[model samples]
Target: MRGKHAPRSTRWPIIILVIIAVILAPIIYGASSRNRTTKNQTTVSKKTSHSSISSSSSVKSSSTSSLSQSSSSSDVKLKSAWNTTKNKQLSAFMSQWQTEMNQTYSGTYDGQKPDYYGISFPTALENGRLSGHIKFDNQNTTVEWSPNANSSAKNQVLAVAVGQTSSNGYNRILYLFIAQEKQPKVYVSQTTNGEDLYFTETQNTALKDGFSQIYNSN
Candidate 1:
């Protein structure tokens, strides 16, 4: 009887331990599960933040590139327009003068024939007056002249004329002419000597006025 009672008491202690373990098992498991969920949520949040920053950076880069391209395109368009307008004005002035001069001088003068001519826009001006260098050149010679305030001819237009002279087998010679609005005398110079020479233009008033208008507009 003593042995059987001792065995039964030992069995009761073992049963109580089993019952406590069973009650704590579910609580421990729930705590562990919550810990795992919290860890996962934290990791996902970090990844989302990193992705947002990368996306924002990409958007900013794209915007900057677009603005740069737009600015470049605008500059190109402005340059093109300027070139077009310049060519048109130059063409009109050349046509008017060439036609008038050709009609006036149909014959050669002393074995000298006018070959071709070109007019240049004023490089520098002050207070609507020419105050800079006007350059003329050909295959052989290049000449430049500066007009100042004290210059007898405060001209705005510069014309370079090329003519063939019979001396030395029809050699080419260059002549420089300057003119202004309502001015009867056209300032003249040659490559040989850059001196003050003038010729009166009683005719071709329209040509002079047209050239003056172009210069002033510029």
Candidate 2:
């Protein structure tokens, strides 16, 4: 009887352990489910952060590319209008002036080379025509010319020959123009010490008219 009763007593401990496990099973499962949910949420948050960064970077890159393209287009337009070639009349005039300047300034002046002259097409002018302000010395009048209309004169070919000289800290700029027409005429304006020293043949009606045709026509 004692042996049978002792076996029954050992079975009580095993039964108690089974009951405790049954009670704790749901708690363990709930904890595991919460851990899985937290892991999923963390993964989603990381992906969202990466996506936002990528989108921002894409926008910045697009903006930079647009600005670069705009700048390149502007440069192309400027280069297209910058004229470097001279017409027949302009070529002859440039040659004559170059010869004269070289003869007058045979050596260097003020530590710089003399007879530095060339043709320059101002980009600021419409049709890239050569135009500037001319203020004569000791005079209150300032002469200026610029094209304003897109007429036949806009299509007219014009050229400017520029001659530069400097002496004793004083600089001179010589601008010459020869209208390309049936009767080509010459116009000259010279600047020294922030003032025009002289202008040649500017009052001639025929020459003025010829120049205006090209100068006023944008």
Candidate 3:
């Protein structure tokens, strides 16, 4: 029986070692688990922060794009307005023109001749619609005057200065709105007095405004 039993002191040391292992195992496991949890939390926090930054960047980019678009649209509108106001050929001729409107037309198209109209107070003499004669005795009747309100091409016109005709009318009162090519040439109906027929400064300004009104009305 004595041989089978180990010493008490040696058994005590073995027991103590087992107790120490038991206590340290739980503490080490707990520390490792806490470290793993802390690491997982740090990873999640980094991901969330990155996502927030991306979202903020996207919103800023969209705002910048919208502002650029608005600025671009505004520039286009301003350029369009400039193009409309800087009429080159039209403006150049208008600056030198000085003819005052001596006549106003009723613009009432005749029933008989659809193309014909009446003048309100024509200084020139002619047998025309204002006289209540709708019927034309001649098929090749004269226009009696140019720059009538009925012409659609009023904006692209310039009158020539021919002298008064022997009939006391604008020599070639029968002219039509002059084409761009014929703008510089002398008109057949130009005043006979050899005086220049360009509109006066005041007359030119009025005519420009009148044509603008007509354009708007149309």
TM-score of each: 0.41, 0.39, 0.36
Count of clashing residue pairs in every prediction:
0, 1, 15
Candidate 3 RMSD to the real structure: 13.7
TM-score of structure candidate 2? 0.39
User: Highest TM-score among the candidates is held by which one?
Assistant: 1
lDDT tens per residue, model 3, 98-217 = 223343212111111112112222323233433222112222222332332223332222231221224444333322223222121112222222221222122234544543432233
Cα RMSD (angstroms) for every candidate in the order listed: 12.7, 13.9, 13.7
Name the candidate, 1 or 2, with the larger TM-score value.
1
Runs in model 1 lying further than 4 Å from the true structure? 1-6, 84-126, 129-218
Write down the lDDT that model 2 would get.
0.44
The residue pairs that clash in candidate 1, if any, are none
Worst 10 residues of 1 by lDDT: 103-112
Q: Per-residue alpha-carbon lDDT of model 2 for 24-124, expressed as tens digits?
A: 99999999999999999999999999999999999999999999999999776444331232233334434554565552222111122223132223332
The Cα error of candidate 3 at residue 149, in Å, is: 25
